[model samples]
Target: MANTPQSKKRARQNERRFQINKARRSRIRTFLRRVEEAIASGDKSAAGDALKAAQPELMRGVSKGVFHKNTASRKISRLASRVNALG
Candidate 1:
């Protein structure tokens, strides 16, 4: 329905951005799932390693506008707390 050339270009750009963001979000979720699984398995070292790896991916999601800043912060905080509690 994009009649104007500019609108068509914008639609294309939006679609591209959507795919990229979707992939980024899925990647972030995968990293978070790894951490959750490690935590659930009660392995402190594995959980720590997973958290370390996931932290950057989550932060990257925030930086890339895939996630909100506070949302990422909250997730990191909660995961860190859970990891710390696995004493």
Candidate 2:
């Protein structure tokens, strides 16, 4: 229960932020999934393209504070390696 006006305002802001972050997280997941699917399909070129597309989205997630920089970097590294292996 937010008794004070400031607390109420904060609660509203929190809800708004939660929704926004949720959407961003979902979008990131969608990009990751696309890369994974492309990889699984055994098309190196498609996977590479998908990885290229996902890279910026992952970094955007980091920039927006949805994901840690290291985490994004690690994911990108792993995905790149997998894509390379597909060759």
Candidate 3:
């Protein structure tokens, strides 16, 4: 439990940030899933388009600290490769 007032405030802030980050994470997942589905469907153009849309969202997640830069870059690299392979 948070005993001090400052601790309580910090706990509150943590909870708020957690909720915001959760939502952001979920949104990013949705974008990624779109790319996955497009890839799975074997549509090169669609997958490429989905990747284009997802790139910024992924980078935004990185910028906001939801994902590490290398992690985001790895994801983009793998997805781009898969998309390219579909051609």
Candidate 4:
């Protein structure tokens, strides 16, 4: 329904941003999954490594507005605890 030229351009921009944000979200999920898998396998070292890798991605998601800051912090806290409990 974007009949006006400006609206049509904005619609296109929205679509592009949606695709980019979706990809970033998916990438963040992949990092989280890696940490989960490492924890599930009871590999403390691997879990720690995965957590280290994922920490930045989760924070990046917060910075990019894909996730809330406290949500990311909570996730990192839970994952760190699980990692610590492994050893």
Q: For this target, which candidate reaches the highest TM-score against the unseen true structure?
A: 3
TM-score-based ranking: 3, 2, 1, 4
Q: Candidate 3: lDDT over CA atoms?
A: 0.97
Better of 1 and 3 by TM-score: 3
lDDT of each: 0.98, 0.97, 0.97, 0.97
Model 4 spans > 4 angstroms off: none
Q: Lowest-scoring 10 consecutive residues by lDDT in candidate 1? A: 58-67
For candidate 3, the 10 contiguous residues with the lowest summed lDDT are 78-87
- Residue 28 lDDT in candidate 3: 93
Error of 3 at 48 (Å): 0.5
Instruction: Report the lDDT of model 4 for residue 39.
Output: 97
lDDT of 4 by residue, 1-87 (tens): 999999999999999999999999999999999999999999999999999999999999999999999999999999999999997
Q: What shift in Å separates residue 49 of candidate 2 from its native position after superposition?
A: 0.4
If scored against the real structure, what TM-score would every candidate get?
0.97, 0.98, 0.98, 0.95
Candidate 3 wrong stretches, greater than 4 Å: none
Relative to the true structure, candidate 3 reaches a TM of 0.98
Per-residue lDDT tens digits of candidate 2, residues 1-87? Answer: 999999999999999999999999999999999999999999999999999999999999999999999999999999999999997
